[model samples]
Structures are given as C-alpha cells and as structure tokens.
Target: MKPFYIDYPQEKIAEHQHAYRCLHCKIPTTIIFGLLENHAKDCAYRIHQGRWTQLEASLKPIQKHFDEPHIDEVD
Candidate 1:
C-alpha cells in the first residue's frame, strides 16, 4: 500500500503536545510520541489512501522464497 503520511509541524501545541493531521482525511489529531498510525486505521478515508493489495504484490516474491524448505544442521 502507498504510505499514508501525517503532517507534523515543527511547532508544538504547548510543551510536549504535537498536532497531527491526516493528509487524506483532513482530520486533526493530537499526540506526543504516540501511535500516530492509529488515526489512519480509524479514518473513513483510509481506503482512498491506498490498497493493501499493492503491499501483498510486492511481498509475493519474498514470501515464495521463504516458503521453500531449507536443510538445518543438528549438533
């Protein structure tokens, strides 16, 4: 999926508070070194951000290699 980037301005809200906004949904969020990703997960416009299919497609080749059996040494 394409990355959903949040806007974090250089200025702080108060002292330790930082304001964040979703570029896709235009929703305001306040956080302090917290999980900014949670906003995107609950955002209504998350679907417009990107699709998980893109990520799956990119990982298919890597996943295929990992699926192959490997010989392990026993001591």
Candidate 2:
C-alpha cells in the first residue's frame, strides 16, 4: 500500500489502538486517505511539517488480476 498520512491525536497514539503505528515513537497513528490543508487537531503527524502526501491508486489493477474471464474458450 502507498504511504498515506493521517493526523492522529497524541493521546490516541499512547493507546496504540490504530493499526498504523508512528514511525518515530512506534505509537498508533491515524490514516488520511487524501490531502488536506492545516494540521489536524492534536495530531502528532502534521502535514504542514513536511510529510509528503501519499496514497495508493485505485484497486482496479488488483481486482482485474483476480477476475476470471466470462467468455468461453474456443474448442
């Protein structure tokens, strides 16, 4: 998966409930699907700091890989 950013609360980071853990402190962080302006409230990883916006493209490629052909093969 591409590296998407999330602005999680510092307190939540302490609990570590979220799956994505902070790289620096190893604490749980939030996941932001898209880009945004301004730092989120109480977030340890603020986009304003310099964290590059990242995201995984559409899942179409993965789905197509697993999808089976509908038409019958020639005999």
TM-scores of the candidates are 0.29, 0.19
Q: For model 2, state the Cα shift of residue 48 in Å.
A: 5.1
Question: How accurate locally, in lDDT, is each candidate?
Answer: 0.46, 0.42
User: Where does model 2 exceed 4 Å of error?
Assistant: 1-18, 21-30, 34-39, 47-75
What lDDT does candidate 2 reach at residue 3?
42
Candidate 1 local lDDT, 1-75, one digit each (tens)? 334344333333353355645544444554323234554565544453335545677777653345545578454
Alpha-carbon shift of residue 25 in model 2 (angstroms): 11
lDDT of 2 by residue, 1-75 (tens): 334434443343444454554443444433333323233444445533344333224433554455665578563
Candidate 1 achieves a global lDDT of 0.46
